[model samples]
Target: MTTIATPTTLYDPPPSFALVSPFLYRSSVPTSSHLPYLVPLHLKTLLSLGPELPSKALQQWCELQNVRLVHLGRKRDVVGEASTWKPVQEELVKEGLQVLLSRENAPCLVVDPSGVHEVGILIGCLRKLQRWTLSAIFAEYASLAGSQSRDIEEQFIELFDTDLVVIPPLENRIDGVRDVVNDPPLLAPPQ
Candidate 1:
């Protein structure tokens, strides 16, 4: 039996800034599946990120708070390479994007677990939309650990030539053991 976490609190829904949300769906399948529980996405906001990256904790947090989590990738490569992160195949990009376009009126949040390179790819996909707006972007900040973090944050800002906020790392307390996501976006409602 799959155990779904019960929601805890309420948060103001972010406006249709660009895309992202919460509601819940229960399934008989094991929770080990990477595919997140899909809520009705019609005109609903969504949050997406690079492949893998253990976003389940953040996803659950969003669900409990009524924020929708959109699963965009199914493979590790989709997250982009950590060393030379770049966009994947056109088909892969389109596959992930189909979810976003499915709800044209919806706003989305693109969280990059692999840092600037993945975010760059995400931005590239958004640009292809012809008529899409990026309300806000939150880059993952590994920590206050010397220059490495700064370099990654700077790269992320420079990639889009926009201001970027660094979100603290997220730990997967939901699953057994302490699995930590190096960089997970902070869940704050867009103004």
Candidate 2:
């Protein structure tokens, strides 16, 4: 249920995976002046590495060089509108994450397919996630999600297998596709 707002820098995947540069590695981008490298021009990035690595630095370098990185979210919308991602999610369940590159939110999204899906019931999750280095996150918001939310979450998991990490987006608003998630429980996940 977590939603993220980030600096607008995104990375676009190219046609060939072999030809793509290592995300942390530097390569020149052609422009009016000679720049040794630029941040990725796409929206999402999935990495074998954790978020604490030098990705923020790399993004900044790109900005300095006049490259803009539009952030594709792990928790943000694919497009400004909520409608674009419904079919995409179904395709994601069928094909896994490789299909993310071709979506309307291209150049801004990335994901790791390895062990990305897991679910287990844990009561005190904030401490657990904070202390443990898990690939994904999950938790309940206080007494657990309401019946409607629980059902919606089950539907989501049926469509896509993934670990449940509850960040509690907001409470009671009807958006499409993931409208269920936008309205968090009356209680947010507490510390």
Residue-wise C-alpha lDDT for candidate 2, range 104-189, written one tens digit per residue:
32332222221122111111122232332232322332122223224333334433423343322223211111214444455777
Q: How many residue pairs clash in model 2?
A: 29
lDDT of 1 by residue, 84-159 (tens): 5323444344544444334341434444443334444444434423223332322322221223344443343335
The 0-to-1 C-alpha lDDT of every candidate, in the order given, reads 0.37, 0.29
* C-alpha TM-score for every candidate: 0.36, 0.20
Q: What overall lDDT, based on C-alpha atoms, would model 2 receive against the true structure?
A: 0.29
Error of 2 at 69 (Å): 5.2
The numbered model that scores best in TM-score is: 1
Position 67, candidate 1: lDDT: 57
